[model samples]
Target: MASDTDIGSPERPTRPGRWRWLPGSRLGRLIIVLNLVGLTILISGALVLNELRRGLVNARIDSLTTQGELLATIIDQAATVGEPEPMMDGAYAAEILQLLSNPRSQRARLFDAEGRLIADSYWVSDRVEWRTLPPARTRGDGPGLDLNLSGGSEDDPDSADAAKAQAALRAEVNTALRGVHWAGLRVGVDGERVVSVSIPIQHVKAVLGVLTLEARDVDEIIAAERAALLPFILIAVAVSLMSSLLLNRLVAHPVRRLARAADRVRLARARAISVPDISRRDDELGDLSRSLEDMTHALSERIDAIERFAADVAHEIRNPLTSLRSAVETLGLVEEPAARDRLMAVLQNDVQRLDRLVTDISNASRLDAELSREAPTPVDLRRLISDVVSLYQATARLGEPAVTFTAPEGLETVMVSGQEGALGQVLRNLIDNARSFSAPDGVVRVALGRQKGQALIMVDDDGPGIPPENLENIFERFYTSRPKGTAFGGNSGLGLSIARQIILAHDGTVRAENRRRDTSTEGDAPEAAGDIAGARFTVILPEARR
Candidate 1:
């Protein structure tokens, strides 16, 4: 059962559970959504970065390999030359030394066929400095494949202090002569990353001479790439951050505003709700806000309607009370048999009026309760409608004219779950109202079937058609429109109203409209007898299992 306080509250307004509220509401949802989006972008970026690093490293290795091969080809071709060009200065000599001193060569030797040094790129002042170069770590691939450069070409530093770095370069290249791959040496003045390549000369598998030159430019290339990586990464990260911030503002901000507006509307106590009167702009958020504002206005109108009904109910009941009291006073003065009977009749009519008022009040009060009530067992709606119309047709025939049924095919097994009595009462009331407005010999048409997820039961009469104004008010309690000088158009005026109440209690709906009248029979149609002169009442009930 719902609470009394809850009854006054709109059931559709409040819902249970987490309630979609946030710290600043929409802003928080925006932050969370953007953060998740940004995080996904960052993760994807990191994967791309790692792959880029691997590609850069592989590219560097390929460059280094090509450089080594070029140096080796140069050494092979140069080794065929005789003694050093006689006018060679020290600078030219150092260049030549680098060409012959490459460590990847198996040996960098300068020897005559008699086996004496002509000019070993790895030999400086005819003394070997073991400490200048690390020992070769692996054996040559095999005999002829080996270049076998001379080993440890530098003298000890104590003996060659002024040319220590040059000597050190010579020694490193000689040690690498076991099998030179690639090499670097900062040989000139403080070892500034200057380097060389060397290959030994051999004829008929015998040592002949050595050829040497500066080695591939590994140090310079490594230095350049390392410096460029940081700036490139920095620019990429900056762009990503700026883009994310712009997206948060452009996309998330408007959505947050709409969410806040919706929340405030829900929290409001007044029946009239407005959301700052937003316009229907082209943007998506603007459209959403404008729609919310429109919905609020419409909702307020419905609330106003319910409130007016509450007032109308009170006003309507007051008239009958006043009349019933007057009739009671008049009955106390009965002086003859005829006067007494007339006065008694007036009192009875007033009692019936009170009953009608009370019934309307009770029906209105129970709308919510009945809306929530569990349905009764399923009853085939065709059978229910047929039974009601058949019984009421007899009543109609006794009045102004005959009642006729207009059931179509496919209405046989259509069903619904509701109180059978309540449903039957709705149909009988419609038929009774139809008869009241109908002139003698006028026609009453009844229909029953299924449509749009509900069973449809309709009653139409060719009677004094409904006025456009009273079409809405006909179902109001104590709302009668009996033409003067007529004893017909009967009842305490709650027939249609009670009928609507019963249909609605079954999770259904009922509505009335003035049917189009026949021009040929216009003069013959009854006048001012019902909510409408040419009225039609439609009752809809939910479909149930047959």
Candidate 2:
């Protein structure tokens, strides 16, 4: 039994993780990745240095092993001369050790089978202790120490530590005396990396002595390897800088300019947006720029249309108002009963005219908004026209023109995509327009069919044909031209105009033309004397796809 509050409660939202500080802007994201290229270069350089260090140390060990094997071969010959006791010839061994000694950056040593130090290359050479001083003590002291410095202090604690480290070297030699070669890295008493290798001296399966080699300058080799990566680091930095510059110029700067142009339009400082530099580009940003321009232009046109419509409405309302005022003022002065009755009749007419005009204007104003609110569906034009015409026929008076709908022969339906209510209103207006001009006995005909993948509906009447010059003018708002007998202001001119608007909104076209009697042209029907018959209004709409 959980309460509604508990059940409906949402979980707390999690905050974004690291790297969320990156800006949401496109340019900011590009700049971040571009600059990270420099970091990538640093990481790759470090990896390359590490690999070089390993390779160089391994090569040093291999060289030491090779040199030791040659020296061990010579020492094995000298030590094997007294085999059962395994005694080294001191003079011969010393000569061999001296020839191989390298005291400046490397050391060579020889150990007997019993683990006793036989000879050391370091003792044979001149022992210059100042050159071998530890970096910590040397850097701490003054720089101008005597250049001829001979040796370290005999009682120095650091010197005693170095003697103890030399004893630890015996373990590596002893491992070789057990008949196995050894090679590895170790830190010396002076805190420098030493590449050590030891090989056993043997004569026909009898171990005699051990030959050992040490490369003391491994740190220098690693430093040189890092220095070699300098050029790559410089190239990466230059590439990153170039990328940032190009992105700012070609992408970020142009977008910012377009944003500023749109802001001007929003603030009404400019009538429309024109991001010329961005629009010239052939990309998505260019499409956005062009769309903004088109939207602003459309808004400007709509504003102009609204201003003109307001002026027309005022002009149309003023006519009826003036007439009503004249009729009202004259009613009090009319002496005869018939004159007073006529004056009252004029008042009623003007009042009715005002009502009709207001109603039509209201409908026209809301037409565009209402159409946009409703989603369009497939509308069957044949059925829609038939329904409207049937309603009219059902309510017809004795002298009113009869309404009829005709569809193509053998055609079941003609469909178009549009709002049903809107399309229905369009048909009703067209039919009513035709009826207004028709004679008492004339028929207002609605013919529906399809042609060239378009739905076509033609409203025809047996009324007087529209004058050719005024055919297009008839669709203009508040422009009415009725028959002589028809009462003034009986119909508002907005009907045809509203019909055209709704049709156009549905991506359809409407036009007016006169239907004429057939003329004889070699075996054709004979021409009627009057030539003109009645006006025909045709509408063409895109056909609905399956």
> Using TM-score as the measure, which candidate wins?
2
What is candidate 2's lDDT per residue for 12-87, written digit by digit as tens?
3334434445543345456756577656877687867665578889899998888888888877775467736666
Q: Output the worst ten-in-a-row residue range by lDDT, candidate 2.
A: 146-155
| CA RMSD per model (angstroms) | 11.9, 9.7
Best by lDDT: 2
Model 1, 14-108: lDDT tens digits are 34324244222344445555655675686567645654454444554454445545543443344444444311123333345455444542223
User: lDDT of each model, Cα atoms only?
Assistant: 0.57, 0.78
In model 2, where do residues sit more than 4 Å from their true spots? Answer: 1-229, 275-278, 281-285, 374-376, 393-398, 413-415, 520-530
State each candidate's clash count: 35, 0
**RMSD, candidate 1, Å:** 11.9
lDDT of candidate 1 at residue 101, scale 0 to 100:
40
Q: List the residue pairs that clash in candidate 2.
A: none
